[model samples]
Target: MAEFPRNDMATAQDWLRHAVAADAAGDVAVAEQGFLQALLLDAALVDARFGLGVTYFRSARYREAALELRAVMAAGSADAATGILLGKSLYLTGEFPESAKAFELALTSMPLQGDSLRCYARAKTYATMIAGNIADALADYPALAGAEAEPIETVIRDGFGLLSAYGHRDAAAALGQLLITENPDDVVQRHLNDAVAGRAIDHVPASYVEAHFDAFANGFDDKLVNVLGYRVPEQMAELVSRHRTAFDHVLDLGCGTGLAGAHLRPLAGELTGVDLSARMLEQARRRDVYDALTHAEALTHLAAHAATFDLVFAADTLIYFGRLDAVMAAVAEAMTPGGIFAASVETSMHDFEIMPSGRFAHADAYVMRLAEPYFELLERQATDIRLEANTPAKGALFVWRRR
Candidate 1:
């Protein structure tokens, strides 16, 4: 084993060399530590900061990467490469407007790079659409059309159309039209069909959920609580408090940003959280609440730690699960006998339905029937989960004890 140099013994240049070598050798975590050590020795070492930023970018810690890269640029240490990376990090963190600006800056140096141009265009489109700025997004259509080949252009057009239609509350018709242009055997088209018809798909794709939350991670707390009026986490905490004041071990399933953990910390001797998004886990780590936080899919994490938790809570987490059978079974296996499980679901008339927003809604009967065999319902009630497009979104909250 090689002994690494201590921060006090090594100069910033020495640390920079080692960090660069480590990064090129694909030991990014080590490279990040090395870069941090270099920065400690010399705070203004541009190479050290840039190396750390790139390491964070590679690790998919986009928010951290963006902050570091922004600092590097503000200090006048930026180049085309740094600008490109900063743009990518911003885009990954859902800061689309800023991402577009960063990409555009990169283009000033590398003007003819197709990849940069495409990324810039995509960022602008997503920024406009997500902010509900339809006219601005449509205004760029002509330029976007000229940039891509026919097939890619058509997909982009349809994607924008779907976003526009969904914004206008006509998602079903727009989805149908998009599917008509797509190959019948395409998996996404099939999923769109199921979503449009209000039928549950086999299951929500893990990739989709991971990407969605990963992008939303940076602003998740503000977007959920302030912008969307989300309160499921607090509601779950309150419901659990009424039943049992304390738990030996608690699991926060899909614990995005540790919101539930913040509320449930007092009730738990040990708190563990799991989510599919690494970026979301990063945010949760900042809360300093959970004893352990794992970046893993919910069922996979539960299976690995079966029968370990006395209580499990998932606030607004089940929306990503189009079907509940497998997940419910997994939770049952993961819980100790008589363990409590509290969860929330968007309301649906059918047993389960996939909405145009790509979330699942479960009927009250569906939740009750599924859990009846393995758990006993302690409490179930209808509640307003959040505000969607200036309207309250109705949902059901339930607390069940494992049988």
Candidate 2:
């Protein structure tokens, strides 16, 4: 009843074919048993071994699959095709370097084999991510060498550069390593990340905003006022009323449509506003609330004109920054000793701390952490800012004295 010649171990080959067919048809259990049956008869069967390994892989039994494929390689049956597949199995089990070695073997045998080449390239990329500068130092092999380097390699390198710079020496230095002097573009992407990271930000003025705000400028206030529940101006007025004698000049960071201006109109001896969106500034300009309007990266602009404000107010600007050190440090330098800094942030209770998400729902512990180094917390009022993108945005109003 065996599907083979009943001699010469022909049953092994027939069972292996049945396993492969059943596996292709997605009958994993039957395929696994058939592959096992084939291997029982012919212990030297590489096809049945590999088939069983793949079946374990499809069943999400990555450890078992890895064990089997590792045996295949140990048995010296790892050709280019089998080596690449085995490397993938190792990668699934989180053995990255071992996976890379397998991919390297496949690529070494068939250097231009498309699948092998791609897998090999990706394995190296994964190693770079885990190792950082250590990996870069060890990998003396130029990642993008030769005129024939694949376009995908550059993208992977750029992403690595961004991640590296975020935590590494500096993103700029990482970019230097990743830099392709041929036209040498891609600097802007790193700058964008740097800006978002609360590092030195280079403001790249976009013309799109001129048109964007040009269209929305007229009704901008009405939108924020009515739709967004933008009580920034109103809330600011209340804070200023309570601390009216604290400061003489106010620098409104990210002042949109002069909402802060109207609130501090009575308190500000002079008012200046900064925003990335020129269209938003255009709307703010109409209200005559600011003595000056500058289109610059908000913190850079603040740092350039430091110690000028008796009070520096930012409502909802901290959301863009994951860390508050740079902005708060700038505020400390920009304010006179004991100058008051009042602002609104998204705040939440997180393990008894104010976290970064204060722009939405964040730990109050992270909020307090941001406030501690730069300013002494005076008063904080928790309130709902308004619905944004169909969801309500929560906020906290804090008054601090710059230390």
Residue 255 in candidate 2, Cα distance off native in Å: 0.9
Residue-wise lDDT of candidate 1 within 1-403, one digit each (tens)?
A: 1246764667877888888888888998789988998898899998889899999988767788999999999999789988998988886665667988898788788862566666666677766656665556657745863564235445444553444324432333443455556655454445555565656375778776677678889999998888778988988899988999889999999998999978989999999999998999999999999999998989999899878888999998888887799989999999999889999999989888777666788899988998899999999978999865334689989999999
Clash number for model 2?
A: 14
Name the candidate that leads on TM-score: 1
TM-score list, all predictions: 0.57, 0.45
- CA lDDT for candidate 1: 0.79
Once fitted onto the true fold, the runs of candidate 1 whose alpha carbons sit more than 4 angstroms away are 1-200
- Residue ranges of candidate 2 with Cα displaced over 4 Å: 1-219, 348-361, 389-391
lDDT per residue, candidate 2, 209-228, as tens digits?
A: 33444567678778777866
State each model's CA lDDT, in order: 0.79, 0.65
For candidate 1, the clash count comes to: 1
Which 10-residue span in candidate 1 carries the lowest summed lDDT?
Answer: 164-173
